[model samples]
Target: METLITDIKIALGDNDDFFIKRDYLIEEEVVFLGLNTLLDITKTKTTLQKQTESLILKGKTTQLLFNLIGDVFENDTKRAISSILEGKLIIFIENTKQFIIYEPISKSINRSIEIPTNENVIQGPLNSFTEDIDTNIGLLRKQLISKQLIVHTTSTGMVQKTNVSLLYLNDKVDQKLVDNIKSLIEKNNDLEITDLQGLSKMLEFSSWDTISKFNTTELPFHASQFLKRGRVILFVNQLPFALILPNLIWDMFIVENDRNFPFPIMIAIRFLRIIGILVALIAPGLYVALVAVNPEVLQIELALSVAQSREGVPYPALVEVIIMLIVLELIIEASVRLPKSVGQTITMVGGIILGQAVVEAKLVSNLLIIILAATTIANSTLVGTQSTTSIRLFKYINIILSSLYGVLGLVTGIVLICSYFASLTTFGKSYLYLNIERKDNSG
Candidate 1:
């Protein structure tokens, strides 16, 4: 009991200097009360002492001679510890180990609220989840009041003690999937509790060299949608994002805005997104392969134009393409690191001025310029940064392979990438078989 008091004092320190008073109720009966705030000591005297004794004596086999303090120790260890640090006073009755927890929350609620940047909406709730897990959970719980809306939370990060919640509808969700997620989190391996990326890498079935085959989302609407579809959602405290499982390649092409738009418009946009991904992934590679080795496929006028554009350039087609690609990537990197307004300005100036200058200098062909620009624009159409990054990386592999074996190498790279995707499985479920209908013998 004294150790607990010491811990409380240490947690409070100079910020909350609660006075510890020891007094006698009757002869041989003593009480110790730790008071930081005045309101707790003033209201309800006899009940406070009774509540404290009951709490400390809870589940105890031996009779405690000391009168325990009430209000503080009623909760479990985690909640009790959390309350103490948050400015709840712990008072103990003398000759007993019972204690009471006083509620005097030091939290301030004056901050102005704003729309979340990551989870912007066209026609939904403007509010987004913040760093507070209770607030986030409250938002979700208000939306889903059913008993089926299960919120199982666990403390992660040994030192940080971060709260991680697994939310799902008990009746609608698969029990096996829930158990799998629970078990995975329970392991609490040192490697499993790092940054979000580390957690993802541990949970994801992608190989050491494989690109990310999962989708991450920040919008609660998306998460709620997935929950209704019998999917599981994993949310980490202090992280603005949540991870969805069993995501397919097509998932990346989807946007929350799709639900607001008309079905036909959404379908058209989805088709365009699919096309964008393909073009972004392979356009530059195809251009490099065709120009370097397969000129026979080009029309006479196109061939002449490319040849004219390449004239007086010292580097080979591959070297020139590689150089331009690297430069474009550097500009993109710089844009990401710069401030938002500055980044936008740099993109405009770099996209136009530098690109046009390089084309006029005969350092790169005009056709290549168009292809690269198209690829960049296509990549930008992807909703998630992960997908965009994956596209960028595959583009490199495609370029290199295309340069080596021409069109055949590009085809081979595609096959290899597809094979890798085929090999991936999350929680023992195949990642790429989302649309495949399976036979349900029992049904």
Candidate 2:
């Protein structure tokens, strides 16, 4: 260990300060002090004894002794020695080579808890999770006061030393789902698993391919409900949200408070969001088909009105709709990136001004303006921005296909979207369609 430490010092150079020493038994108790100027020896002893005694009691260590700032050598070496030199304390026995590293992490930076800005609900708690892992766990424990709740913590990242926890209910969760999640986590050993999104991508079986595989939410109550329904939740250190697995596509459309509402109302809201998703994705395509090639399909009065509205416009129906769609999308992107106050103002001004100006300039028909405005409003109701953006993209694809090939192309696009969605699965479970086996668990 001494030679290894010495070689490491030379290899690492002055970039890192490493001090090691040997322990000599003094007065029945052993004492060896090994620390660089980087460590505060005055408190290292206290932190060291506090960290290792439990491991020693568990029969993992035979003896412990303080090492001088330079006494450490090959006699008691471990790879964790570098961490010890960096303010962590390492305790080694005399005969064997295994050692335990303790981190008395400095509590220097303090962060105050703030209300959740993005997911604010008028009735729920204003408090939100912070960067601290323990604090986040405490928040969950408070919400789910149950003995069956199991939280398994493991160290992830060799250098990052990030703490990741797998939380689930003991009896309710399926064992196979837990095993599958563990398998994925173990396989991605060397990949950087820092953020929740990175961890999600690594755990995804089809990460390199196109697939909607997992569900993530910031609401704690939403997580608690999922735990009760036999799903696995992954909690990453410093991340405000947790990832829930084996997610059904229908699950995302259901809100956290849906179960609290009357059954009829819940069903209505869920169906409404589903309808909104359809409108957001296909409204423009429908408008293009009707106005561009099927104006006779509409009744006489409506057809005449549309014809009169577009009489002064120079562009074709498809071009006019696509142009307005692009402008609306730009406004939406800008609103999302701006501050909340500014976002509201931008949405209002952009919606009213652009809508009126386009009609006044005879750029697009009045009916198409209404269709585009409805499409934008429908897209905003989705819970997650990721899913919303995805649906928005699909909307553009639908518009392009309809513009080129008319009504039949819109039908073909629908079939293709259904086929793509149906082909996705997470760990052998269906991702898009609902399972009727558990008919009573819709809530």
Candidate 3:
């Protein structure tokens, strides 16, 4: 016991927050080890003192004394040390050479469940996941309310040992899919995962892929929906979002809240989102192609009007599109990184100033300004930020191709994107597969 204490002290170093409280229990020297910030010192000490008094009055044996501690108590030295580090109170009985680790009485510091700010839905549960994992699990359980909703927890990360939970409907999910997810997690057990991105990469999901292989959401209702669809959900400690695995292409177009609306309305909204994606992806390219390479395709009056619009622009259509795209991207990045109030002001002011200045300087046509603005607005309609980012990035491909071969190049770029998406898979499940018809579709 003395050697274990010494090792723990050495490992923790001289941090001022680390505390050791010595006392007497059942005529044996008792010691409590924990972090001051994490443990409720007064409550722990009082509880220990009261239990010690009770044992003495009853003349209980050491075996009885051990029974009073929680089930988390262990005889293993390494595990005891780990528990102490993880904010658990470690109680050592010097004479018996025994140690019991249990939960501390720390104040609740987690934020209360609130409406999701990022993934807003018009008619669904407003509650979002919090930083506390147990709270998050409780939310999931409340929504699922089924015995088949299985949750398995394991610790990862070398030094910090962050907890990760795997959730799925046992009867609904495929056995092979569960095995595959567990296998990947076990292989990456040594990784120091600090966030969702780290875990995604550890699972061998490519970060550079244009389409995200995981659908992340903060709403427990959405997570429940994913589980019902036979998808695996991963929840990391301290992260406010859960990751839905084997992210399919259809997941990008559908929103969980859509189910609350009329069927036709839901279908119409999804169709509009798809249209938004297409316009965002191909609008700039088509504009450049028609003006620079395929002007003959337009009617005489429309072609004449386009020519008049571009009369004062000194640069080629491609250069002009690229310049505006860069500016738009810069504004977007800056707005996202800034405070919301400041971001709105900056975006509005920056767009007006840059658009006016560039047009006055005859650098880009007025018609191209409208096209880029519309394209930027359309890009915002994608389901997730990652998906929106992918769409925005792939637009450059269409822009480049159209510069080379006009409408034909734009069409080719679209086909290439579709082919790439169709060829992709996550955990052996095809990305392009649609699971709308079946409840337990594994593809």
Candidate 4:
């Protein structure tokens, strides 16, 4: 049974990080194996000693007993060795086929919690939340005080146990939703969950899911509001934001802070946001369709102006749109990656210089400049990064369809988008469910 362990040692070829020791865990004799380079030696041993004792006392055999970032692997020579490379400690029973992967405390990350400089909110709420789990929960605890307020903490990841805290109003929260979430967390107890996107997989959302299943925010007030409305707030260790489940379609248009404004003003703003959504989804496709495939759809003067703006451009309307879109995406990516001072200068100067240069060079039409600029601006109007990304994905579908079938393709794209949204669900609640209210219906 220790042949697997023997094989790993040979494969590693006498590395300094690879070390083993004879030990007794829970009165069971075993050998401890790990890489010293990856593990914080003192913390790793301490966590396993305490957490394993708790697991046994709680009548659990398997859990965060391996590499902190990986899962419980099969009894294979390669994977056993791979787990060691991924910063996991393996506990092999001397004569048994069983082996437990103990928690590996990773090297400390050197950084202090800072406010999010990336995202901007119109109706600003104070976000004093930080990376530390205790500090974040303490912030939320101050805002939510009730007997039913449950903050259930658990560990995930096989390599290292990352803390996950579930905050919900027990009396108000739907039991089914909580049960379902807990079950997934338990099922994947040995799997690492570092981000909400990975958590989506735990919820069984497939690759085709364009709309994010949860809403994320850094503000304690926002998380508290969602909890009161019978929604769950999931806090991942070191994640600066709290993940609010069942990200509904309305989240694109409505936010809790907006209610501070007068009702009519909120309504007007929401209406404009909806219009922006449509523009982001349809503008590029509509422009291509009208210019290339359905010129007669436009009035004579408008069509003439469009044609004149496109003069001397050497590519088809679709290619021209794609070229310009790629440039826009490059600029956006660059802006995000560069420093703030540099990013602003790059975006401002890049947009002006590039836009003018492309038009003069006839690489793209002048009319497309107006449409794609509007598209980029409208895309920014959506609430979440995930929402904007999902909507942005649909434009490619629309572009392809419209290039083939004109106005009919754009209509087809719209219908498909609607149907997709209608079928989306998060924890059994419809994605389209807007207002926060209690209901018995899970369908």
Cα TM-score per model: 0.79, 0.77, 0.94, 0.74
Residue 345 CA error for candidate 1 (Å)? 1.2
Error of 3 at 154 (Å): 1.6
Tens digit of per-residue lDDT, candidate 4, span 1-443? 56877787787758977788888766667787888887886787687788667767766644333333234445766656766776777777666766765557877552454555535656756665677787788878887877888988887777656888888888778888888888888887777777776777766777567777878877787788888888898888888888888788887876777888899998888898999999999999999899889999999999999999988999999999988888888888898899887888988798999999999998888889999999999998888777888887889889988999999999999999899999988778888876655655655
Which segments of candidate 2 are over 4 A away from where they belong?
1-105, 108-110, 158-161, 195-197, 208-211, 435-443
Error of 1 at 386 (Å): 1.6
Candidate structures ordered by lDDT, highest first: 3, 4, 2, 1
Writing each residue's lDDT as its tens digit, candidate 1 over 1-443 gives: 56655665565445554566665432334334343453344443455456545655575322232223324343243454565444464545454555555543233542323576755577766666666666667767776677878989887655456677888887677778789778867775334444656666545443554446456776666767667766677677666666666566666677766878889998998889988988997898898888898888889998888888788777877898789888889989988788997897987797799988987887888888888889999998777777788778888888889989889988988887788778777666675756422233564
Output the worst ten-in-a-row residue range by lDDT, candidate 1. Answer: 61-70
Mark the regions of model 4 whose C-alpha exceeds 4 Å error after superposition. 1-114, 439-443
Cα lDDT tens digits, model 3, 91-155, are 88785567877666875567999999789879989999998898999999999999999998989
For model 4, what is the alpha-carbon lDDT of residue 66?
34
The numbered model that scores best in lDDT is: 3
lDDT scores in order = 0.68, 0.69, 0.85, 0.80
TM match of model 2 to true structure: 0.77
Candidate 1 clash total? 16
- Per-residue lDDT of candidate 2, residues 1-443 (tens digit): 34444554564445534444444222223323234444555466565555455555555523333232223333444454455544564544344343445444343453566776566564565667676667777777888999989998866666556677888887788777778887777777556677755786657665553434557776677778888877778788777776777767677487777667789987987888898889987899988877787667789998888799888999988789878888888887787788887888978887899789979998888988889878988987776655676778788777878877778878888888878778777777777756412223644
**After superposing candidate 3, which stretches have Cα over 4 Å from the reference?**
47-62, 72-75, 436-443
